[model samples]
Target: MYTLAVCAEMVFRDLPIEERARRLHDAGFQVEIWDWTRHDLAALERTGAVFSSMTGYIRGSLTDEDDAAELLRTAEESVKAAALLGCPRLNLHGTGLDGRGLPVDPVAGEATGPMWIAAHRTLGRVAELGESAGVVFTLENLNTAVDHPGVPFAKAADTLALVAAVNRPGLKMNLDLYHAQIGEGNLIELVRRAHGLGLIGEIQVADVPGRCEPGTGEIAYPAVARALADLGYDGTVAMEAWASGDDDLALDRFRTAFTV
Candidate 1:
């Protein structure tokens, strides 16, 4: 059996977070807090989506620096927020090293060494802080080639490296298949590899190319599901897809993919 959560932004708009949680309950899906700005602990208590996790980092209102100390402070606050809301997980990323639009020559230690070092230091602090707060920090991959090209961890291997460098139990990888399929196409193989290494903390899915509902595109989700089951992966498989109309189509697609 696969537990499903929908990215909050994908299913619900900028309405009150409590109303969004109510709608998620009505739709029979858990809410994955994609937009942290809209989070409400009271709403979480009412909706029971507290068991769910989020995607992005806590922004300006949350933290204001890129150094290790700042990262630790931010992680502490995020854990406090999660615990206050009864959330157990908070998905995070290695930002700030994103060149934005600058040209980098790898030969000049341009984008690789500095970015990796910063990620290692910052996320290491996050790991330490999260450990004390009992909240897991899941680092996700971004599709840097086409979408979000400036992000540092744009591939699966890069995310894995960061986690390894942090070398903490509280820090884990968030393997969202949508980004994986687009950025690293060996879906089943990579899942198997991550499982083999005991690194994957969570997994998510959606069709590639367009990040739409499953079964509407080219990803072999059934095979991926089989691989996950084979690895005894019983974690939440959140849906991070776009819904042009009714999200029932998206839900149906997941039902087909997971066969639940």
Candidate 2:
């Protein structure tokens, strides 16, 4: 009942990215990626894979004045990269994440009032960029308690607040359930709340604890799938987790989990 995609960055690790894209394509799924700059865009374009989304900027923060400007500049460049792959939704974060997936300069505990204010202003400008470029930008949530400790606006609730505050058609929430299950417990209600507002551009998923494929951990994805279907949410639900075992089998489980 929804478009399915798998993150190439998380799956099929042994193959080249182009091949990974092709593999997902051949397996009847669109592909998602992180950091378009690291790949040869020409090769990716040649893979004939329908891309769902990619990281929207190279380096910048939503809460910094200078970095916000850099975010806008680099985001414009990211739009060009997305064009090559026909990716319609570009992903964003509160700040630039390092190679280790840690925030460049984290906001310990809570961000200052000025930081939130700056983020709002920066995201407003980011929405303008998305509007003019004809691409939607999705601000993703991360769990500070686990994978991404100390990142500002890392909670799903905080992200929802910011995206709702911006309230632009060009900007929307990525609404990752994996992170949400860690940071916030109510998946069905969160989906309902975000969907009810028309604020969700995509829903990313993985089972909790291990960050592995569905059915390999604690999340009841089939129920989540049914909830999305019940809400008439027909947008993308992408797998953004590593395989627990054989990659193909992992893909199979992911498909079955969402097979409502």
- The candidate that wins on TM-score is 2
Q: Which pairs of residues have clashing backbones in candidate 1?
A: none
State residue 235's C-alpha deviation in candidate 1, in Å.
Answer: 1.0
- Per-model TM-score, in order, reads 0.85, 0.99
lDDT by residue (tens digit), candidate 1, 66-151: 44455455556677667666777788754422224221211221246666676676777677767877877888876766556555
* lDDT of candidate 2 at residue 175, scale 0 to 100: 97
What tens-digit string does per-residue lDDT give for candidate 2 at 68-164? 8999899999999999899999999988899989998788779889999999999999899899989999999999888888788988999999999
Candidate 1, residue 167: the lDDT equals 79
Q: What C-alpha lDDT does candidate 2 achieve relative to the native structure? A: 0.94
Model 1 segments beyond 4 Å from truth? Answer: 12-16, 59-68, 96-110
User: Could you tell me how far off, in angstroms, the CA of residue 94 lies in candidate 1 after the best superposition?
Assistant: 1.8
Against the unseen true structure, what C-alpha lDDT does each candidate score?
0.68, 0.94
